[model samples]
Target: MALDKRFIGREYGPFTYTIGAEKLREFALAVGGARPGAGTPGEPPAHVSPLLYDARAAKAGPYFDLIAFPSFAVVFAVRPFSAAIADPELAVNMLMLVHGEQELEFLDVMRPGDVMTTTGRIENIFDKARMSFLVVSSESRNQTGKTVVKGTWTAVIRGG
Candidate 1:
């Protein structure tokens, strides 16, 4: 069955997340190809920037604090997309769905202790060839209500 076009524009949450320094370091190290172990995020790779893991170095650098890696926004930013996919109303077939594409725009730096709130809505639902496509647009804001990230998420479901 095809996805109902009437579901387009359905809204998802104002999900909230609080950025933590340790998680930031862990994410950077993991993405930078470090091996993690008990109680440590692991030794950061040489190519990784100290501004992402070292508080002291970050404190002296431009942002004056440990800053999250640019892509870390996806952690909190993906909430709404997740919600939409899991929503029973959509009746989406999980096994047939794959993440199609993603685009994120970072408008500001993220730091530890910053709280973020995200909201999104289904932007489009369409069928092409033999597949169905779902697109959702999201925005995340800092505690002060500044837009920190904007995202466009796409999911494609193959015809069974």
Candidate 2:
């Protein structure tokens, strides 16, 4: 089935989520360090860096708690669109859909304890070679109402 062009500008969700320090710390350590408990890059010590997992040291800096990794927006942004794609009126080809690409623009620092509100919209949709390409844009804002991240998700549905 071809995607309904009428739904191109459809919007979805203002889903809210709270960033957790422990989860942020865990994500940081997983990405930044050489290895857990190994300390291979032993010079600076992992604790000094917010991405290295030292709860106390992370707070010593300007940010009172662990700062989220730049790409952490994925955790807060994707869920809001579940309803949009699942809409019966849209009739998306779920089994034939494949993620195409993603683009994220970080507007501001996202820190732990910040309440994030994310909303998504169907920005564009097109068809070519029996495939449908859909672009969904999701924006996330902090409690203070500042946009922290903007994510553009692209999905290609085969045989559309």
Candidate 3:
């Protein structure tokens, strides 16, 4: 069955997530980057390994404190759209779906202990040849009500 085009412009979720220091460090480790959220052992001056080892580097950084890796926004923001695409009423064929593309804009650095609210909307729906495309845009805001990240996720759903 083809996806319902009328579903375009549909909105989903103002989901909330709180960033935790442990999760941030774990994500950094999983992605194999310098431990931006891991604190140096012992005291500051002599014990510090460098900027890479500073857990509070984001705070000490030119950007913000406990800065999150940009990709981390997807952790909180993508869920709403995931729910939307999986909605049975959308009548999407799960096996036919392929991740098309993803674009994310970092408006502000995410910090540990910050609470984020993510909202998702179906931005566009179109078809080309035998494939249908669904484009979803999700924006995440910090507790301060500032947008921190905006992400666009595109999916290609193949038709029989």
Candidate 4:
């Protein structure tokens, strides 16, 4: 079954994701970047109070600025998207799909100790030539309700 267009505009989630400094640095290191968070450290930035160990503060440092890399949002999108793309009848394999476009607008930068959330919705779907394209928009917000980032990602569904 193809993705039901009726699902468009339907919001899914409020899923909480704790953006820990450890996780951030780990993600960075996994991609061969800096290894700053937990176990491996080189003193975080001064303003990164969240990493300070109580009164035993070491001193903060620069953290993972995801966009500086590429498509870092993948860490946050896998689950919801897996569910979204898994329409058993569609015969669509999201992996073989191409990431045609990606846009992220950040209202605020995520920081350590921040509990953020994400919600996704299908924004558009169109067919052209021999394939279909699905555009899904998801917003990540901190506990304060501040939108940390909004991602607009497109996937080309082939053989649809």
Number of the top candidate by lDDT? 1
lDDT of 4 at 39: 64
Off by over 4 Å in 2: 29-52, 62-64
Q: Each candidate: how many clashes? A: 0, 0, 3, 7
Which ranges of candidate 1 are over 4 A from the true structure? none
Q: Provide the RMSD of all predictions against the true structure, rounded to 1 decimal.
A: 0.9, 4.3, 5.3, 6.0
Per-residue lDDT tens digits of candidate 4, residues 48-125? 333232222323334443321223445675444544666464445776578778788866656566777788877877
lDDT of each prediction vs. the true structure? 0.95, 0.78, 0.76, 0.60
Tell me the TM-score of model 2. 0.81
- For 124-148, candidate 3 gives per-residue lDDT tens digits of 8888888989899998999999998
Please provide TM-scores, in order, for all candidate models, with all chains considered together: 0.97, 0.81, 0.81, 0.68
Which regions of candidate 4 fall more than 4 Å away from where they truly are? 1-4, 32-72, 77-79, 87-91
Candidates arranged by lDDT, highest first: 1, 2, 3, 4
Regions of candidate 3 where Cα sits further than 4 Å from its true position: 33-53, 56-59
The alpha-carbon deviation from the true structure for residue 117 of candidate 3, after best TM-score superposition, in angstroms, is 0.4
Residues 19-112, candidate 2, lDDT per residue (tens digit)?
Answer: 9876665566565653455533233334546433565766786766667878777887986456667789888878998888899999877777
Lowest summed-lDDT stretch of 10 residues in model 2?
39-48
Per-residue lDDT of model 1, residues 4-110, tens digit only: 99999999989999999999999999999999999998998999999999999999999999999999999999998899889898988999999999999999999
What TM value does model 4 have?
0.68
